[model samples]
Target: MAPGQKLYPRATVRKVVKAHSGCNVSKNVDVMIFLDYMLFMQDLMKEATIEAKQGGERGVTARSINKVTKKTLSKFKG
Candidate 1:
């Protein structure tokens, strides 16, 4: 979370998530997507900390890390 940012609605997030549940993106895309997601979260966390240090409000954003985990599992499943 950040200043003036609202959390994504659970239902909306769920809908977005469900649509991507079976995405057939390639391995390279998968890796890049996951890596980009992780990096984005990491940066957010850092920003949150900095904001908190500055006495501004800080918050956490929910992200899907398991998608990549499932992708990895799928690779081994077959």
Candidate 2:
């Protein structure tokens, strides 16, 4: 799985449940809840990553503008 990929395919759920079969948690209810929780978390993480990326881009633009303004002010003063 590549970094930042949030796709939680059914195959993954099946694998997890199969791996945990010895724990008596292979029931439909338990599996459904687990899958739902996993999907919810994945969505939250995806949103957070996207928001952070957008904020970072805005920060870069703000810094660039600040730098240009400072340079212009310095030139005017000199």
Candidate 3:
């Protein structure tokens, strides 16, 4: 993402979920899902960034993301 672009917050995601599902989630569930999602993305990005650097990319470009996505997902899989 570009500079200053914000990730979706937990409240925003909860609102979206409620809009789609027509039900409210408990606060604890929402927070747990939000934090897990954030942490997963953060870890995935870190792996992609390292791959990008190894590939001589100036930044984490789409190529780097695509290259690392499958491996990252497998690593993060439960």
Q: Which candidate is the best by lDDT?
A: 3
Model 3, range 4-46, lDDT digits (tens) per residue? Answer: 9987676777887788879777756677776878888998899
Error of 2 at 47 (Å): 0.5
- Number of colliding residue pairs in each model: 1, 0, 0
TM-score of each: 0.38, 0.37, 0.61
TM-score, model 1 to reference: 0.38
Candidate 1 wrongly placed segments (more than 4 Å): 1-27, 56-78
By lDDT, the better pick of 1 and 2 is 2
> What are the per-residue Cα lDDT tens digits for candidate 2 across 1-78?
899998767666666776766454443645576776676555544554555566675333444444345444444341
lDDT for predicted candidate 1 compared with the true structure: 0.50
State each model's CA lDDT, in order.
0.50, 0.55, 0.83
Per-residue lDDT of 1-78 in model 1, one digit per residue for the tens?
Answer: 679998646555445545777654443454455576776666555554554555533433223333234444444342
Using TM-score, rank the candidates from best to worst. Answer: 3, 1, 2
Candidate 2 lDDT (Cα, 0 to 1): 0.55
Error of 2 at 75 (Å): 52
Q: Which one wins on TM-score?
A: 3
Candidate 2: segments with Cα more than 4 A from true spot: 1-27, 57-78
What ranking emerges by lDDT with the best candidate at the front?
Answer: 3, 2, 1
Alpha carbon lDDT at 33, candidate 3: 70
